[model samples]
Target: MEQTETPPPGRRVALAVLGLSAMTIMANATVASSLPGLKRHFADVAGIDTLAGLIVTLPSLAVVITAGLMGWLADRMDRQKLLAFVALCYGLGGTSGLWAESLNAILAGRLLLGVGVAGTMTLGMTWSADLWQGAARARFLGLQGAAISVAGIVFMLTGGALAGLHWRGAFAVYALILPVAVLALLALAPYSRERRRAAPVAKGMARQAGFPWAAFAFVGSLGFVFQAAFYITPTRLPFRLEELGVANPLAVGALMAALVAVSAPVSLAYGRIRRHVSAMSVFGLSFALIGAGFVAHALAQDWHGVLAGSVIAGLGMGLSMPNYTTWFLARVPMAMRGRASGLLTTAFFLGQFASPLVSAPLVAHLGLAGAFGAVGGTLIGLGLLLAVAQIWWPEQARPETAPAAVS
Candidate 1:
């Protein structure tokens, strides 16, 4: 793999931006460890079970609704300013829970946090597309996944500890984004302005080429399924653990951390994995691992078995996430990266928002283990179908094109 050298402040700045991107995951997972606490605190609220779940899903819902518009703005506006502004909002919205006295107010804060997430996520990947190319791009995307996994462990543990003190304490983790906002302003602002001036016409040219609607749809659908499957752990596992006689938030955090911790190493190995397998094949393998993990979870009679299943699913998550973004980036032209990235973000989070709804019925009828078995079976079937399709239609499975331009 040829490494394409990027001009200017180089890998240091790129790494900083990537580090900031980890905050997006923190916003979601940090709250997971706090869910049990929140549920207890708001025990009087009607339908509290569903409302407690909303604390986690609301941000994703906001992301799904707003990411496309944010992406569109990224292509036409100043990305640095957009990112920094959103980072500020992310901190404020996420931390609003600390002072909010009512459930509705807290939900409002999560909604605002979602808007911030939509922009930061859309712009973060667009920046990667703009700054690097070839193997470096692939490596950076893998690093993005690694960073998110590492952040998940740290934030989940922090949130769990804080939740033990008070549910509001976990909300304080959102305040970390304030410093990240400052870092983005200092590191990314100047370079972003320079890039904007150099390629004022890139957006128009990209529009002229027409959006790759078919490719966007394909990637979006795949993202939806993968994310829904991945979300089953954070959204439902705490409750599942309770059913198996583990009610401690810290223990739940550790188990969830184990899942993401396994993912970190696998994500870092993604560049190497791509060396031996086509992106399509990698996708197939990811689904297979996820399915098998779910099956393991379904059959678990104890938390240890659940942990094993989580680790397996984490491997699938680590590989598939980077693969999805890398595959989308490769297919889209430079001008369309922001919008395309936004659509991908929307699809992924939409799946997150839908995970509970999709699984709750199964939880109601079949129990958690049975739900896992059902989802696992579906994913394994999907994986096998994709593999067979790849063999039968290699050309469609692996389309060739000139490398994306490094703007």
Candidate 2:
């Protein structure tokens, strides 16, 4: 009997995978600039201020709620097909605001959009794990982070432009994903089926070792903290700009885009940074940068001051995603990748959902600028603590080797 080798994932497949990666960021970013518009449109509703923030974060809450199931499905189903289906859902759910007649209707749409995000985001990470390993995987994850940052800039700008026209116009940006769904089906379905047949040993090994709950909890906590602090950009920055007397949605979007723009170069450099630095140390540095950026925001007297803070915070954003993702993926077994990705998505977005909840009270007491100051101070302290721990207990911060490749 002769055995055939599975073909490598081609460039088309890589392109498809990268495109899907962008969707995870797009899940909420496309509408962030629209929040002010949404609030104005629905001003008559009860609790418009808080509810407006929810519009930006509702998908995150949805992702938190649905990610576990998405993870379970990722392990059980044909990943390519599932990705296609979910991409379609992203388009439909994301665009719902375009015609949604009331605030409640738009909220319902955002909930559905979150469900789609859970599946797409989980699958993107799972597929990346499936297709690459070791340094190559690290490099690719860095590139993925870079690509996501670029997408954030585009989505933020587009959403802002649409919001300028009307708050509902931004929802049309989601319709673009429908084509990406087609590309995923065409590019990935056949390759994935063949790979699954070739990787039975990996599945069995994963089954035997079981899920790493402790490691996941540690990594997930990192994700949660990073996102909670970082999400302040998308959730709070627009309002901060408003207070600065910048009212145009396009200008708001551009400033928000600037926040993401600075992250791209840093993300592109992450693979090299990992070679010299432990993941824990990398995280510490990222926290410090983000903290400093936020403090800058709190101190901003004008739009230029806010922009400077955004650029600084963006650098931290660039470093954090690849580190958290690479740290966890290196430790997990093949069969458990989907569940692992699911856990990551849940933790990250759960933080996003919590940001407003945690910060709103502070805002009431301290004012918006004061809230930024408080969060910034806490993050800076946490970063220092992490750096100290890494130095004193070096073993805790040592980078882990990825599991040997399954040939």
Best by lDDT: 2
Cα TM-score per model: 0.90, 0.88
lDDT of 1 by residue, 140-229 (tens): 778889998788777877887897788789999889887777777777877777867766576666656667788778878988998887
Candidate 2 lDDT over 198-265, as tens digits, reads 56876887777677788789889878888877777766788988999988876887787786788898
What range of 10 consecutive residues in model 1 has the weakest lDDT sum?
A: 395-404
User: Stretches of candidate 2 above 4 Å error?
Assistant: 1-8, 32-54, 99-105, 164-167, 239-252, 392-400, 403-407
Clashing pairs in 1: none
- Runs of candidate 1 with Cα error greater than 4 angstroms are 1-11, 32-50, 242-248, 395-407
What is the Cα-based lDDT of residue 278 in candidate 2?
Answer: 81
C-alpha lDDT of residue 190 in model 1: 72
